[model samples]
Target: MVKCCSAIGCASRCLPNSKLKGLTFHVFPTDENIKKKWVLAMKRLDVNAAGIWEPKKGDVLCSRHFKKTDFDRSTPNIKLKPGVIPSIFESPYQFQEHSYSVMDSPKKLKHKLDHVISELEDTKESLQNVLDREKHFQKSLRKTIRELKEECLISEDTARRLDVFCWECCQESTE
Candidate 1:
């Protein structure tokens, strides 16, 4: 069966002459993360349900949607490189991910968008803080474990004999 480009506004197909020009058809990536990306590149909001896209068996994208680096042409059968994503799209509508409410003026829309961006930034900052704290806690926990292991072999001693308190936690407040 002839595979066609699944991307929006693309009509390229795997024809006799198409292959002579190095045109190739690629199935959607089996990797869920990569497959989602290809689906998003299709620029069809209707393709996804519950924020996930499930590609049909016939779903395929042509070579024109990717950069040269996206493919590994070294082998006789050209294959896509690891983690390569489709970057090219023909439709102008593909780039839009948001639409302002009809009730709002342009200025109001801009203000609302700015407010949403600020909230996103704040959330990102908070998530980073939590991750930073987790990293530091892990580091301190590792240090404590190392010390305890050194004092009494963890395998043999069962870590009961060694005082297991974290050094960072026990330290006097510098402030």
Candidate 2:
């Protein structure tokens, strides 16, 4: 299964064929202290409960949340600098728990505000639809690549036939 960025409001995932090839995911730290810091930066919590969100072992954060300097270029594989925390975030669903219409009783202002909020919700839904489509595309692409890889391998008999076919082509070209 493809790992997605654990950061709230981030939709980046590990799709090798995706346009977001630059997107890299880092596993949550094993150390308790560093892990806590990472979780704190995430600003996520169990909605039904009080405690902060604790990531499972497979959970990861995408590179977009980190600064360019956070990566260690000296290493062949991209790696995070020690103790770096993800700071970048976009809260698509992080609206206030209560609407201002409750407190600010001006009906005219409230109507305009509600209209804007409605548009925001529609935009958020559209974004979610796009992400879902991308996920489907990734799954389909992976399946196609796997099938192509499987089809490319020739049995010994097929390989011998291919060699003969190539030789015939070469003779035809020469003639």
Candidate 3:
């Protein structure tokens, strides 16, 4: 019943723990080709165990191996999309030292920082625009409700006047 991340370096267990919150375990794909692809990818990560063992149905890979893009998150519960494969891995370091060599150079680090700041500013602007649109919609809805109430009042007043006029005319004709 105990589930743990199948990734070689990951120690994430699927037990209820503060650190492991939101983590999910995924079963190996049922399709033969996809299963083979997953097994190959796992083998690549576990170089020592390569070609030694094959993954079966009961074997599971944890969420850490996948990027957010790898899963379809439109539904309440996230699901792996059909034909999509997990390529990301949970290594010891957050990022591989060789890949993040830009951090070692002052100029490259500054450029990366600037790029991150620009992205953050763009995201903030986009969020503000969405909030403004929601406020406008709420104002329009309130105005529409007020207009409907006024129209209803006018309609009731017209109907009452017509009824009184008919009563007067009927009384005169009877006289």
lDDT winner among the candidates? 2
lDDT of 1 at 126: 95
Candidate 3 residues lying further than 4 Å off, grouped into runs, are 17-20, 44-52, 90-175
Which 10 residues in a row give candidate 3 its minimum summed lDDT?
A: 94-103
Overall lDDT per candidate, in order of appearance? 0.74, 0.76, 0.69
> What's model 2's lDDT at 68?
97
**How many residue pairs collide in each prediction?**
0, 0, 0
Candidate with more favorable, higher lDDT: 1 or 3? 1
TM-score of each: 0.48, 0.52, 0.44
Ranking by TM-score: 2, 1, 3
Give the clash total for candidate 1. 0
Put down candidate 1 lDDT per residue, 89-122, tens digits, no spaces: 8774534544531356689889989999999999
Clashing pairs in 3: none
Ranking by lDDT: 2, 1, 3
Predicted candidate 3 versus true structure: per-residue lDDT over 1-175, tens digit per residue: 7776666667877676723486777888889899878766764433466444566557788877787888888988778888777687655354346654224678877887999999999999998887677656556654655565577854655655654665565456445
Candidate 2: C-alpha lDDT: 0.76
TM-score of candidate 3 versus the correct structure, residues matched by position? 0.44
